[model samples]
Target chain A: MDISFTSLLWGFLLIIIPTYFLHHYRTGLVKDTLIAALRMTAQLFLIGFYLKYMFDLNLWWLNVLWVIIMAGVASQTIIKRTNLSLRQMFVPITIALICSVAIIDIYFMGLIVRQDNLFETRYFIPISGMILGNMLSANVIAMNTYYGVLRRERTNYLFRLANGASAHEARSPFMRDALIKSFNPTIASMAVMGLIALPGTMTGQILGGSDPDVAIKYQIMLMISIFASSLISVLLTLALTHHKIFNKYEMPI
Target chain B: MIQFNNTYFIYDEKPLISGFSVNIARGEKVVIYGPSGSGKSTLVHAILGFVQAEQGEIIVNNLPISPDSINEIRQLTSWLPQDISLPYNSVRDMILAPFEFKANHSRKPSDQEILAEFDKLKLEHNLLEKGITEISGGQKQRILLLTTVLLRKPILLLDEPTSALDAQSVDLVINYLKSLTDTTIIAISHDEKFINAFDRKLLIGQF
Candidate 1:
């Protein structure tokens, strides 16, 4: 059932018809979409080559190294996406993502899956990627929401401080707000997951010939992994980076 | 006591207050009068540690204002900024927000006491149950004033507290403030009526 490289090349023809229509309409997104498709194709092929070697080696240290690199990239992406200063944010975010990824991936492998070799590439790499990807989005949302509200309503924050609130007390509401805003989308999507859309990992598992029951179980476990990792990463990043965002007088930076 | 010794403040690289000096003994009610953009608000904020004086020292009760001392200084002063941005929740919540802080947690007022103060300030008791957005700006200002006074801080720094209020409410507030004979009041105000109630008037914008 797998498509060969020749068949995949033919698949490019299917994309060209829509791209032609887009060009005719002067949508101006034709170049961007074509570029994006080309990038995706090239990047996936490169990763495919790298991952083949990675899996063949199956060295625990190498697997851990791969996950660490994934976490580093996720941290950088989160900072870049939020338009925050990377120099101020990247280190804390990397620490947070790495800590969460290591803990969650270990829990998933050892306790949940009960694997004898926890760092086996087949289970570790893809699962770690899922957790890091989800955590990346959550961290972006949390940072943006927290800083946005603080910046916009800075006077309100100071007013609270002037009225006898300690800095921690004053920031409680903003912290709660940011966490809720960050978790809301994930929670809502979880609520309607199967009815609205089959998740990609679950679909991929089924398409790859796994039994439906086994695929569903893995899907549930992965969702929990993603949720826990996201929560841990965001909270840790926020806590570790709080000092950077506020001055000594507790003013919003 | 509050003292500003040759304080210099610059906003956006332009000097707003330069070589400014002032002194007020404890329990004195001083009103700073200035036109818009004259840095009167900035002067008040500097005392509250919201704005820093670029040069010279701002001393309250003989203690200089610094990052380490700002919290303690602020605890002794309640500053009401010109822009009254209250939480859009029940009026009671907005007023009680300060009390929830550990510093003031023990000073949480009874509902009866809060309602009585609201009545005195011309704020309706029903407004306490309503959302803050339902109230007028004057009501919000008075609620903030009420919250400040309830803290019973020794020093009060108010920025145009009566700017949103009517003549009658202004009189009520001025009188209530006047009755606090031992409290130090440093206010920024333009209303002739409110200014007349203060013990001393400092005219800014001379620079």
Candidate 2:
């Protein structure tokens, strides 16, 4: 809300790319700088448009539907990033996101704050969008680690498979890696909260005239939701990706 | 027992080994000797299901193997790969890797068994505490051998298990491998000394 639409849009377009290469981070510097600026603008503009219309309508079914769509798109990105098969990824990941997101949302809306309408536009839309965004990021990290570790330790995984380990056993190392990688940032962020940095959500709350204590409470709830969502999503992705990547014989290359 | 029927392997659509057919019965210690680029490593890798073959059938223990069944075949076979990269946890973890699988999970050998194998390779008891990154190439090869042996697979596929060893180390490895002849040992190497008293030789040519 604090970020104006024109500033956000034009500012991104006006992004100046550094032409000369720096010492260490010079790999694709100009292209990356330009592309990143463009991508950020386009992505944020698209989200802004979508959010405007979505909030205007404010229907519960539409909100729920959007969340599902966001989840699907996020899953697709995850699949593409990891180069994993998509045959059976839909069910496990969707189920994980729904369960984890709903748990925290229900507690925040129903029990703690007890908002007037459980499906109100003001509360449901922003929180849900935030949850979806967090979920997407967490899953990317998780799925990335899972796929990377599996590839790097291919021999070890094959060795496990040969030793009569099931598909789960073969993928245990990757699963552990995925879960750890996915959850690490959130854990670190929480650990350093209010000391090293103030999170965006809490800052936004303070700017909106909310008390610091209230903002802190909201931030706490969000951390829990992000953590929970990340954990469940990572676990689900790891388990399902194992099945999708491996054949009936547990071969992963 | 293993059978390679007209196996043809290609990488980037370029044939490495073509029309290569061979067979090995149980407890037969056969050596595959070839020039550097003759696809000897490729053939060994193919049998392990690591390298995909363009055309041909490979049957191990009477089961036809595709790229997928590499895991199944690997369970029943021990491997000392030509590239001896043991980049995992500690040296102990590297050595005990075979026992961590379902096929050999129940057979996590006692300390005495591990110590015996280590002693046989003239390794020290303290080597178990060291990390894989800290081990020498020869030591890593010995760990790989012990790890592969712990699998107790019927077929043992070795790729230059002694190519880098000193004469004494080579002698030790060869004798230990010789004693484990209950396995169908098909070793790929160009070392004339190792193959001097070998049971049989399959000389490979440029593909």
Candidate 3:
């Protein structure tokens, strides 16, 4: 957590060699590398400043506000991906994002992790960020799959509906396909967990001088919580936002 | 039976079909002919519950149609739109799309039945496994037409089914549609040959 000038200098130096090599390996990666580097530095610096104040206060409302902000940003990103106008999607997107992140944060911090203090910024903030990250990805896939598949296979979906299929039934195959693609990484990572390697969360704990057993226990709990939260968030977003995305007659927005 | 009781539909406040009342009897073959922008496609879509009439009761089989009843009405009709939006699947797969519904899943025709149907359409059995994305428009029309017929619905709404085809395919389609034993046929066409084959025509424009 130290942010000395030496640390900053070393970070820049570390990136120089890798960025230079990437530029050589892929001639087109120069712009992409520069953008990513700039984004990372700006985002991390802002986050560090924000966290310094939030952790200094360590108030529950401040922690919750930050989580909401993150969720709102994630939902906005999802909205930007679709064909629908941004103004039309605000209500549904916000509902899905807030409901998802709040429920996930509560479950992760309150029930599973069981912090000594409910407002512990260290425990709540990092966990909420991780959960939001997973939820963001799942929602994007759900959005892409739900609308993209409808556009691509309009006839099939129409035929199904015309054949007395409800929206849920008509869209089941595409939804299933999209969910599979989105969740494949997490599912695979779970299967290869202990056998392949230690997860980053557990490694972080061990690096910070916690007992291996304690880190292992925390990792198991977090993984389970993440899996459950992700399932509910993805399912809820797909279900709730669908009504708004379609007109009463099931026309695309 | 389908009856439009003074159906008034407007798209973006521009009236498409206003006070349009039309009754299509069961087992009737009716062709809808008009120029572009004549609301032919819109009418067809309204029948299938794809579009909502602004102010009218569309009665089907003696009941005022609600959104809940749309499924039942749709079950009794087959539609082949002017544009085919078949996905990246095989021709055989596309033909079998309708029957994948649970209502029709159990009733998929046997191989012999399918072959017999394909034979009537002059479709080669080898094309069964061919990719749908690779098929010609003519082939797509024929297959889609065949699939609709297989639904065993009493009504058919064809939107320019022959517009993109050669003379032979048009002849085949017109003949097939005309010769069907007992089905209510609604075809939207401007072709002279297609018009000559129809028993009754509703010319939307110049009336």
- Scored by DockQ, the top model is 1
**TM-score of chain A taken by itself, candidate 1:** 0.92
Model 2 stretches with alpha carbons more than 4 Å out: A1-53, A72-119, A159-166, A240-249, B51-55, B66-72
Ranking by DockQ: 1, 3, 2
Candidate 3 recovers a fraction of native contacts equal to 0.40
lDDT of 1 by residue, A152-234 (tens): 88888888888888888888888889999999998888899899989999999899899989999999889888988899988
lDDT of 3 by residue, B1-207 (tens): 889889988877797777888998887888888878878888888888888888988887776667677767877777887776755478777777778777777768766777767777788888777897677778778888888888777888788888888887788887778777688888899888888788888877554
For model 2 chain B, the run of ten residues with the poorest summed lDDT: B78-87
Q: Model 3 chain B, poorest ten-residue lDDT window?
A: B80-89
DockQ comparison, 1 vs 3, better candidate? 1
Q: What's the DockQ for every one of the candidates?
A: 0.76, 0.27, 0.41
Model 3 gets an lDDT of 0.78
lDDT, residue A117, candidate 3: 76
RMSD of each: 2.4, 4.4, 3.9
Clashes of 3: 0
Predictions in order: chain A TM-score: 0.92, 0.80, 0.87
Give model 1's TM-score versus the native structure: 0.92
